[model samples]
Target: MGSANVASTLVYMAERCTSMRYLKLIHAHAYRTCLHQHTVVLGKLFRFVAVSPFGDLSYAHNMFDQMPHPSTFFYNILIRAHSHSTTPSFSTLFFNRMRQNGVAPDEFSFTFLLKSRSFTTPFVYDTHGAVFKFGFSRHLHVQNTLIHLYAVGGVTLSAGRVFEDALKVGLDVDVVSWSGLLVAHVRAGELDVARKIFDEMPLRDVVSWTTMLSGYSQAKRPREALALFQEMRFAGVWPDEVTVLSVITACAELGDGEMGRMVHRFVDENGFGWMVALCNALIDMYGKCGCLEEAWCVFHRMKRKSLITWNAMMMVCANHGNADDAFRLFEWMIDSRVVPDGVTVLALLVAYAHKGLIDEGIRLFESMQRDYGVEPRIEHYGAVVDMLGRSGRLQEAHDLLTSMPIPSNDVIWGALLGACRIYGDVDMGEKVIKKLLELKPNEGGYYILLRDIYVAAGRTVEANEMRQAMLASGARKTPGYSWVEA
Candidate 1:
């Protein structure tokens, strides 16, 4: 074949190469045709093996090592691939080698390096310096990546400076630049500032809208998040899976089942129903909305269930007081070879807690670290304590609290205190209140709870004394409010 035809044929075959074995055959063919030495041919082959689903990084590395003169493009492909790998530090190592080989690093080189998950503050600063040295500090893509790196590191000031510098230099900052700045403020919990920036953006894409929505959802402003979703739709911006996930989470928080159903229907109609993450979010939304049947329907319809999917369904059952179903799901999860993580075990423990299965709950709690290799967290301890307290096992619950490896928090102490009032154990109540006071001396609610306990126990003198103590402490009881969806 002619050289031009040979190169075209090799490029076509390389594009269709599905497996490493097939790729090797193509490489061997290129070698026999004497085109393997061509940089373009090698670059094509290297890119496929470095990034394709069936590609092998180790094999790509070998090919790179054999190249007589590797280009910046070759270095970039490897660096980008490694940036998402388990050891993202390899991305920097490749960059160092690229510099050593005298291959000029482009904006993409710095962009991928800044994206490395192994980034520390010092590493980020070092990269920021390199960006300036390479004169790529002005490149919007590189600048945006630096913004994300700074934001994630909680350096909102530095991130803002990068964005401002871009604007000062007339860099034509786009949606990504705005989104990166929004993320910086959002990560710092400065949602108001983020919203102002979002509003000020000359143009907003799905990413800009999603980042703002996620910030609101994560900051526990679910109502605002939903309102923004309405605005997003009205602005004619189609929601991606990520956008829908945040909206569903907001709906879950508000317990707005009607809104959840609407989001679910949108997912189905807009071709987002196939995403496992969206399905998982839908299950959680339905579960929190007290729509167990709807949660179950979503669960059963999923063809591929992740560990999170099972945990969400199990928690749904547990939340609705369906302990038996939760247990059944656990068994089925085990049969399906989906190993239970901390969340899965926590869901089962929550089930035992709600059903008042004291023995079962205790057994599971004890075996958590030993059997499932999942160490119990504070939430697990809290669930078990709440369970024991509910069953009037105040002493046992108190003992568990004190004996826990982690220090007891007000919620655990409060659970035991509430139990003491229920069983009219004045002595235990006094003891629990003392511990609670030590933790939260100015908490008026704890004092009020203790005063109520004293009144219930007919200890009028102590009740009067507690009332005086509450007034003297100057601690105000937080007003209670309820949410009613209109």
Candidate 2:
């Protein structure tokens, strides 16, 4: 027991691994001892994730299934992980899977699940059944979840039904319930009704203010959101990370850097340093607000910077076309042991490809599987095709196209056709046009690309024939798109 306890403590400490190599070593040791299951600490989840990093939801599902006796707690952890960087469906699918396994859900399960399903997928019926099945229909938390599910799930009428049910059952109609309905009302474009609920609530928290602020913000009521934000601040309700995140997002959309700076001061004064999410949000806010220096400062200051943190920061470099700086940061990120996933790869590849750095693109791409253990997904493949096609190595691009196990889809074909126009390979262009026509027989753009290739090669007859085919297909390309960079 002592040995197991000591090992668990060690596993807990391993979650603090600052270096990627150390994280991998800790991950290996934990997996060797099967501490992922035996160790009940939440940090084990991070270990499982560190060993089995991004773009693979299958591993998380597999581990969850292998657990000796999975609890709601573990299920919640896995569900949230699966939900993010993917879809809410990941969480909902597993929730159903858990039911099939005869594990009853608790209030927390419904809460998280409801939170994941944001005003989408009509789960009100299933949710109601789950409540009755679990005999938690009368439980305040369950009712709160039911209200949340319908309100967020976009079934405004159904949410009202749940609220009516809450009233009939004499359940405690507290702030949470009203908040859900208020959000629903606001979502249904009933901001006036939402405001009514806000005024009627006997008590309000920072979340209440944040909710109204978000509602107003989304509805283009920034003045109202800011006004309510001021009113809430005067009410002495301490703002939370949620409030800060929402306000920062709003400020970014409006390009309100000064307002964002005000929020930043509040965040700093409140000493919310441990909230890594807020830290990342601060970085994102500054980046969007055109404060890259401040964004960089926040990124380095963050005690914990998730993959998104790196991606967000990397994007600023990518946008500036600071290819050298972007590549430098990307190299530093991978060297520091941060696992590069599809987003990381795609962004950096774009920078390299735009800069005509073909060698660098291929090297980094090949290292995905050989060095990083990340299987190249379709997105990665698309980036390579785009990179090579744009660099005028159409033949190399065409050769590489045949090697992918995945079919050469529209994206690849589009890149090839684009390269055809740039490099004017009429023969390859003609061949690719057939492939494109086969896929999009009615798409006028394919014929236009073929015509453009022929024109560039001074093959007037071929260009005229392709134009005739466009007339035959009754498909026409939209006006040439303008690409202006400041």
The top-ranked prediction according to lDDT is 1
Candidates' C-alpha lDDT: 0.88, 0.74
lDDT of 2 at 227: 75
- Give the best candidate by TM-score: 1
lDDT of 1: 0.88
**Model 2 ranges off by over 4 Å:** 1-142, 151-157, 166-174, 182-239, 247-266, 284-291, 330-339, 407-412, 430-450, 458-486
Estimate the TM-score of every prediction: 0.91, 0.58
lDDT by residue (tens digit), candidate 2, 242-291: 87777777777776789888988888888876677777777777877788
Global lDDT for candidate 2? Answer: 0.74
Residue 371 shift from truth in candidate 1, angstroms: 4.4
Model 1, 345-364: lDDT tens digits are: 88998899888898989999
lDDT of 1 at 274: 85
lDDT of 2 at 305: 69
